[model samples]
Target: MIKSRAVIARGKGEPVEVVRIDLPEPGPGEVLVRVQACGVCHTDLHYREGGINDEFPFLLGHEAAGVVEAVGPGVPDVSENDFVVLNWRAVCGQCRACSRGKPWYCFDTNNADQPMRLEDGTELSPALGIGAFSERTLVHAGQCTRVDPAARPVVVSLLGCGVMAGIGAAINTGGVTRGDSVAVIGCGGVGNGSIAGAALAGAEKVIAVDRDPKKLAWAEEFGATHTVNAAETDAVAAIRSLTGGNGADVVIDAVGRPETFEQAFYARDLAGTAVLVGVPTPEMEIKLPLLDVFGRGGAVKSSWYGDCLPSRDFPMLTNLHQQGRLPLDKFVTEEITLDEVEDAFAKMQRGEVLRSVVVF
Candidate 1:
């Protein structure tokens, strides 16, 4: 075991605490990683706020890029000194989803069986099974997806979560293709990623809908063809008008709010696809007209981690970034220390930055 300073959330609605913790050595099927950089994802904030669950003193931070430092017994594919991006969904190939040949939807996922503990020996729950807000972390071997070390760690880490979700929503779930018209609601990290994905997939028109002009500007940089300020106009009407009065071929609701979902529902062309990539609170509910649902004649789907297979998509996207084809660098607004996570959260809430990455 080794002592590592880590960010820990002790309780619900409590401020995160940066304290010393004991990290255990990796066991079978596990690998130890020296975290190089980690993205301060909104999900980390959600975990601290207890929106995710009651698990606390939760080890916070998950979107990370690191180098393998050690390998456990029986591990074969990875070795020390390899650079990798951490993934939450490490597929268990024996699961039903994998049996059906869709490993991305694998029913069972795995993580490090051992737990990191406090100095007092109190067991700590790692957020999303990653717990990467530290100098190092232990993870299942499958959680490590090797990538080109030349890529920026801060930018590539974002792909392990929100960015991947957005891109997958457009390219994988929504099946966006060349010449298709696409509309994305919400201008956050995930939404902007969808815009990029749509652009990469050769969508004829990529419309960005959001309340913030700053976020809309970022969307344009990521490859949006048109912008709609929802606060100033009817989003559905504007989308339809921009798409030749027929609505977009695919509309993605990245906001996950009832009103925003309703807008996405109506903003699609006849028989067009609707993808919901945003996460919602449990207390919120939506009551859509059943007739409209029947008439829509298209799929309304939720993208789980962008329905991405990390092993396949990670390398592909990283290669694109290396080739200067993908603009991953646009996502990094600032680099921060682990101690400034709370401040970073404030900046995120205030929309001051796209991502505040913790660079070790």
Candidate 2:
């Protein structure tokens, strides 16, 4: 066992602390990774607030890029020294989703067989099955998708979650094509990712909607052709106005609120796609007119992790970043240490940063 300092949320609503924990050696089908960088994502904050579960003493942090330090028995896909981005969905080939050839929807994902424990021997529940806020973490071999070593870990790590989700929402879920008009609600990391993805997919116009002017400006950098200050204007009306009074070809709601979702639903042209990429709470519900749903004549989709297959998307995105086609680096608003995660969370909540990466 090795001692690694990691951020731990001991209880519901408790402040996270950096503490030393016992990290065990990799078991079968597992790999030990030395995390180079991890992004402070909202999901980690959700886990801390017990919004995810009652899993206390939670080992937080999941959006990460790292180097494989060790591989356990029967691990064949990756080897030591491989540069990788961690993914929560390590597809099981035998699962129903994988059997149907949609491994991205793999129902039975894999995690490490063993656990990292505290000094008192309490097992830690890793956030998204990848507790990467530490110097090192153990995960299923399949969870570590190899990517270009030339790419910066701090930038590519965002691909492990939010950025990937946003990009996937636009490209995969939305099926955005060349000359399409796309509008993305919420201008945070995921929303900017959708904007970028739409641009990368050759969309003629990408509209960004947000209440924060700073975030809207950032959206421009990510390829938004127009901005809608939702706080000042009717978002649905503004989106329609931007797209020749016909609404966008694809509209994505990155803010999971009912109001924003309603805006997205109404902001798409006839037969156009409306995607929900935001994570909404359990009690939060939407009540749309049944006639509107039938009259819309388009798909209403919920994007799960951007409908991405990490093994396929991670390398492709890394290559795009390396080629300067995808501005992945622009997502890194700041770099911090593990100790500053609490402050980073505050910055994130205040919309001060797109992503505050923790560099080990």
Candidate 3:
């Protein structure tokens, strides 16, 4: 067993604390990771607030890059000292979706079966099946995806979650390609990623929509050709005007609210795809005109982890990072110690940062 200091959230709105926790040795098919860096993601905050579920005593933090410290029996893909980014999708091969060759939609994805416990013996629930807030964590072997050793942990760690979501939303879910006009609603990390993905896919015109002027400007760096400040004007109108009043070839709603969803719905060309990349709360609901749903001859899809296949996407994205094409480094707005996560959460609530990474 190993004792390490980690961030632990007790319940909804409860405070997070630096507490000692016990991480046992890796069991069968498990790998122990010595986390190098972890990003402060909105989803972690959501998990802290119980917005995700009532699973309290949560071990917070995901979006991590690390070095494999130890491996259990039969784990051949990753070895000690390998640099890797952690993934939540520890896909189960025999699952209904995986059996159909769609491992991206694996329903039986899993994490470490044994819990990391607090010093007092309280088992802590790791966030997103990762729990990278700690100095070390145990995860299913399948969750480990090797990346380039030359890549910096702080830079590549962002791709473990939010960045990957945005890129995959545009590339895989939205099917963005050369000459496809794309619009992204909400210019946060995910939104900016979508813009970058569209640009990488060679989208001719990429539109960005957000209420914050600063975020709108940030979107431009990610290849947004047009920006719409919803605070100053109707977003749908701006997107339409930029797309020659025909709506965009693809519209991705990164905000995940019913209102933004409606905007994405109306901001797509007829028969164009609408990708909902943002996660929504249970209390929230979307009520669109039934007739419009029937009249719009396109797919309305929700992207979970951007429908990514970690083994394939991680190395490719890391190469993009190495080649200086993907601005994975830009997604990291700041770096802080794990102790600063509480204040980081506050900044996230105010929409003041894209990410505040915890560097070991």
Whole-model lDDT, candidate 3?
0.92
Pairs of colliding residues, candidate 2: none
Q: Which stretches in model 2 have alpha-carbon errors above 4 Å? A: none
Candidate 1 error regions (>4 Å): none
Clashing residue pairs for model 3: none
Worst 10 residues of 3 by lDDT: 72-81
lDDT per residue (tens digit) for residues 1-360 in model 2: 988999999999888999999988999999999999999999999999999999798999999999999999999889999999999989998988999999988999999989999988999999999999999999999999999998899999999999999999999999999999999999999999999999999999999999999999999999999999989999999999888899999999999999999999999999989999999999999999999999989899999999999999999999999999999999999999999999998998888999999999
Writing each residue's lDDT as its tens digit, candidate 1 over 1-360 gives: 888889999999888989999988889999999998999988999999999999789999999999999999978888999999999999999988999999999888999999999999999999889999999999999999999988888889988898999999999999999999999999989999999999999999999999999999999999999999999999999999998899999999998988888899899999999899999999989999899999888888989999999999999999998888889899999999999999999999999998899999
C-alpha lDDT of all candidate models, in order: 0.93, 0.96, 0.92
Q: After superposition, how far is residue 130 of candidate 1 from its true place, in Å?
A: 0.4
Per-candidate total of colliding backbone pairs: 0, 0, 0
Q: For candidate 2, give the lDDT of residue 23.
A: 89
Q: Which candidate leads the pack in lDDT?
A: 2
